[model samples]
Target: MQTGISYCFLLGWLLCSCSETKSNHNQSIQDTAAVLLQQDSTSVFTTTALVEDTTVRFDMSEVPSEPDTKIKILEIGNFHNNEVWKGADNKQWYGLFQTTTGYYVKKTIVQVKTVYDALLDTKYVWSGKQVSVSDKDTCLLLITGISLPERNIDTVVMSQKTIWPSEKISFTVDSITYTLRATGKRQKISNEVSDYRLYISIIKDGVEKQQLLVVHDVFDDTMTVVMWVGDLDGDYKPDAIIDVSNHYNNHRPALFLSGEASEKEIMKKVAEFSQLGC
Candidate 1:
């Protein structure tokens, strides 16, 4: 809720650079998890504890007081002379800055959570940053950012047209909880409105990128789900897998699209809930 932090000219350039230059536009950006680590005298990562669900942990105080690492904002543009300020809810703080292409300063709120790694079976807190995009003219813009851990790149950036379904939604195949909020509307295929939720999780492996998405549909009453494991990030080779559901109670098969090696694998049950019936 603070104002006059700096001149708005800087925001103008960020927009033009992303639009005017096609090559400059980063389309593969996705959501990921991050961890804010501080180097102690022992030169190791020691967790910075704060209040429960408090954004104060990420306060700019840590930014200026300690050695700041270059944390990337997936599915969003990089910041310029950005400063983190505490939100009205003193419990948290946000990264604020003027964009080169806009008249308003961007505000990014973030949180951290530790999740169990299925592969390693260990717990790791993933940083999640939410960015709200606004302009002087538009009082309410739908654009927001979610920063995932480096391993999980490719953040999602969408307007109100694509607010993901949070109910029954999840990031991983085994997740019992939903990560996004969804409307009850069904897609007719003709409509750009997607009732399904797409989750892309990536981890950096040397120079190559590993991308995986848990795209599923839970709108229908039937048991329908799709699991895709491939390079949805478009890195030339096809390294993904897709699974479509096959329902029992008179439901149709679903479609699960994945990989680029050849045919797009379609899940039988997934088709059951497809827009074909909607």
Candidate 2:
């Protein structure tokens, strides 16, 4: 019986040792798996960091910067004929005569009434000539003078005092439609009369922003502003065309480049009237 008890005890101890060895093996396998998982996570993190660095170091030097602001000044002349006329009855009349020296002389005629045998005859007498003058000349003559219709100074002054209506302008850039309102304001330049300033308002993406553009009048009565969209710089992006004219005779073209910030900036003055290939 003692021998049988010893064998049973030995068998029980052997079984317990086997269970402990199995548990140790399982624990070792679990630790190895955990280590492998940590290695894999570290490798993934390193690979992700390298990919981020490569993305951040991408080259962007080829993209062009903002172009320079080009300013062009143009001088406009008058559009009119110059000549003088003398009637067969010795009466003088003002006419337009084209000459190489470019001078326009306006002659005045005086009328005298005489009665002969209950008949009244009116005779025209030629007076001295008066030449057109400029602001710089105390007395001068203009060769290419434009004669506008005589305007009443009082009426013009009254009209100037009245409020002018705003003009609506629209253009498309890159398939996006843009609308602007030109509000008129008077601005005085140096040694010149008060000019009309077109304060522009831009509407984009359902938001309204002001002062996106402004056009200064070169002449008080003959100034005009025109806007359109075109690819002026050959960049394929739609550039804005701001054309200022004086009675459609002198054209000043300005270009606003297209980019991310173009909607909020002003245009650059480009070509004068003479530079246009018309």
CA lDDT of each candidate? 0.28, 0.38
The regions of model 2 sitting more than 4 angstroms off are 1-165, 185-195, 199-201, 234-237, 245-250, 259-263, 270-278
Specify the highest-TM-score model's number.
2
lDDT of 1 by residue, 79-198 (tens): 211212123122222232323332222344443222222332213332222333322333211112222112222222222323334443223322211233334445456333334544
Could you tell me which 10 consecutive residues in candidate 1 have the lowest summed lDDT? 267-276
Worst 10 residues of 2 by lDDT: 150-159
| Residue range 1-278, candidate 2, lDDT tens digits | 99999999999999999999999999999999999999999998988783322221212223223222233211223211111112211333222222343322243232222111112111322222212222221212111112212211110001121122254555555555555554454344532323445544445688765554445554544444444444433343444445554333444544344432354553433433222212
Q: What's the residue-level lDDT of 185 in candidate 2?
A: 49
* Model 1 TM-score relative to the real fold: 0.17
